[model samples]
Target chain A: MSAVEEMIKERLKNDIDPREFDKPEFQRDPFPLYKRLRDHHPVYHDRFHNRWVITRYWDVDAVFQNSEAYTRGIYEEEGPYKFGSRHVFGPNILEYGRGDRHRWLRNVIAGQFVGQKLNDFLPVIDMIARELIDKFRKDGEVELVTQFSHQFPIRVISNMLGLPREDENMFVGWYQALIAGLGFGGVHLARGIAARNEMWEYLEPLINQRSKNPGEDLLSRIIAAELDGVKMDMDEIKGFVALLLAAGGDTTDKAIANMMYHMMYTRPDQFDRVKATPDLWENVFTEMMRYDPVVHTQGRRTVNEMALYDEVIPKGALVLIYLGAGNRDERVFKDPDTFDAFRDDLHMGRENRSGRYKDGKPGHLGFGMGQHFCMGYAMARQEAVLACAYFANSLKNIRPKFKEHAGIFSPNIDSGGFRSPAELWLEFDPE
Target chain B: MKLRVDYKKCEKAGECYYNHTVLFERTDNGFPKILVEDLTTDALRHEAREAIEVCPTGAISIEE
Candidate 1:
């Protein structure tokens, strides 16, 4: 925009109130305010929240790419930190910043989630997905959130761990409470910590058994995955399993719901095409990752002074990267608000850590980019795709119960802006 | 062409060595030690690229 045009736009636009973030309407839908922030205050320093908000596409990518300027993960760099001792997850990978410790943790665990190793777990994913769908298939109408969406991934995780099939409900309960405490404080945090401690104690014997006699299960694989004979210690192993259950399970749980919400409600026409071809389910997954990702805000702290939009963010400032805003960024996407599953502009394949694609298209910022990109990217995408395809295929003529939903929102303030339909009711025929 | 390990970029996120042991091996500290740097055939180059693509940090690349 020209200087005169920019001035006019600025004059017409009203300043944003930081309190707007706390409102229910913003919770239900954040894109409007996100647009305003992107256009006017691309690098907004919200005084009320005492944090810098990054909303644009390139800006969010820049923060993810530049490790020199920002630091992610749960622990701080300044103090002497005991790995995962303090957090509810107990010394998982999330606690480490960018360093040798973080790299070592990531290297050992990441291989299990990608390539043939990830594919090895496919039968379990399919079986669990089928089992969950079987529960409500005979009913012809199902409350998807509790009945299918919530139960599916947690069961898959448990089964992968070689847990007894009967103990899944216990894992589910722990997962729910643990997720509640993830970023939320007060009562939720207390419950979450209690669940974690219980889970840790429960895993002690299991870890011991695995050490003595390893098996073909994921838990055994995790125990045995080594680098130059160095391996994850007991605490690290248990912490990772805890992290995986919540981080991998809960986020994927939300992701599956989001895909259904968009397909059944937002774009019923596209749903018709997908139902007709069925292969387009992958496109639906890709579009949902861009259109409205489950993970909206990714936090980073400025480790060095940085310049953005004529303003300098000093070191130690908290930066909230709004990926929800970035996906809808007009500068990067054409017809940014509309959810088009088959759009050519967006990279519609599996995501990679380096956001740059061989096709030269910008992928969704949902999984994030660069160094700290989601480790479970491949597994999450595959699991969601599998679950969605199975749902649409197995349940004959599956569709939303009603045209309207309560809309996606963070259920609680401490939910860390994770948004999805609280309840998804769907009507389908038994196959 | 030879495989180059960008030490600065590689964070030892074991996507390469663990999955593709044919092209790389793990160091004691978990960094990927290149086992086959020399690529003389299209198949070898293909194998090298596959390794490069999976690195979480984009630390590995082919050097001509």
Candidate 2:
């Protein structure tokens, strides 16, 4: 074996079970394994999947922040969701590009999801949140994930994209199928493909309509958006719209659900604290993200052979940066495991000291760093903050009936993805 | 430690002041007009950074 591969094998022996890749249980509780990997092989390799796993806070953060060493193309591979010729756009348009192209593409979409744009949509999102709560208020129990969590983001995104409510059900199915690929393999893979096709079928006509007669929706805006006087064509527009629905819906849905789960699970006292200080919704959301980042690991392929973690990583090697593990690194966080909702620390950005610090490094790896950091991060944070704040202000007797363990269906650290209590089981007193 | 915002870059998303009213405040113009600054306090710095992340234009930053 090559020297690098040999070192990887040795590291794998110390951490990670061989069955973790395919085992449902491992997917559910991969954190223990992730913790071990961080402890043993901070820069370990997995021969089984041929991926290098970076687990230390500094190492993972470096991978996330360094666009040169760790690139985003490796992570945006065409998965089972790739539809045949039925799709108008090629695979992985926005999520897989490099440098300037990526930045430009991000800007076009960011125009809709970030900054004041989010504020513009707050009223709509609030309406959706209230409508969902109203439906479940009288019921002593509500399955949060299926009934509310899943429903809210779908409607909000669909409306944002100007997709009619008639298409909302189909859109939800597509999102669920695409997101399922992160967890279940076979059937879900097929479902994701079918959903992709269905999405193209649904979006093609919509794209054509927007092309002929544009409106105020995000779809119309992107259709009219320009880059250096070069307008995005129908195929490019479809690709972005599809991507928005998939990436935006899944991440935000899971994040909002995860925030609620963490609030009720780890810090019940904090839940009460939220009620006392509804104004702290923003802080609560930040703490929730810091405590349990939904997108656990982001992958990057090495652009060239380079020295990493006191070892050499060959070019084209897929690198897995363990984001969740980084958030809990004792070297950065004071008490990495404890969830302090009111942690008076700023947990975002490079120079900030919000993470759990052991030695000195910052502990937050919630959003990947650098250029490829989550483009929709601002919007996602807004949705979570508003949603959580609304819940605190309006709902009553909100608590989990049965304990929820880490969900194995979605990717690492997305515990609420699989089946977030079908209902939040709140008696929504609407105070 | 006081939080400083680059009003030029701030789109006034209100994420900073919404979450950290203790250390930061937003002006009517939607920019995070930092209420206070403490360069040494890690707590204040952390909250300031969170505000910075919420800024869509990427305008907010903490200065020691």
Best by DockQ: 1
Q: What does the lDDT read for residue A426 in candidate 2?
A: 37
Candidate 1 runs further than 4 Å off: A1-13, A73-78, A225-230, A412-416, B1-64
Q: Which stretches of candidate 2 lie over 4 Å from their true place?
A: A1-25, A74-90, A182-185, A345-363, A403-431, B1-64
Using lDDT as the measure, the top candidate is: 1
Taking the tens digit of each residue's C-alpha lDDT, what string does model 2 give over A52-151? 8887777776665456666776443345443223332234343553655565566566657765777899999999889887776777666677777777
TM-score of each candidate? 0.86, 0.76
Per-residue C-alpha lDDT of model 1 across residues A119-235, encoded as one tens digit per residue:
899998999898888877889899888888789888888887787798889888898888888867788878988999999899989999997899988788889877557888888
CAPRI verdict (incorrect, acceptable, medium, high) for model 2:
incorrect
lDDT (0 to 1) per candidate? 0.83, 0.65
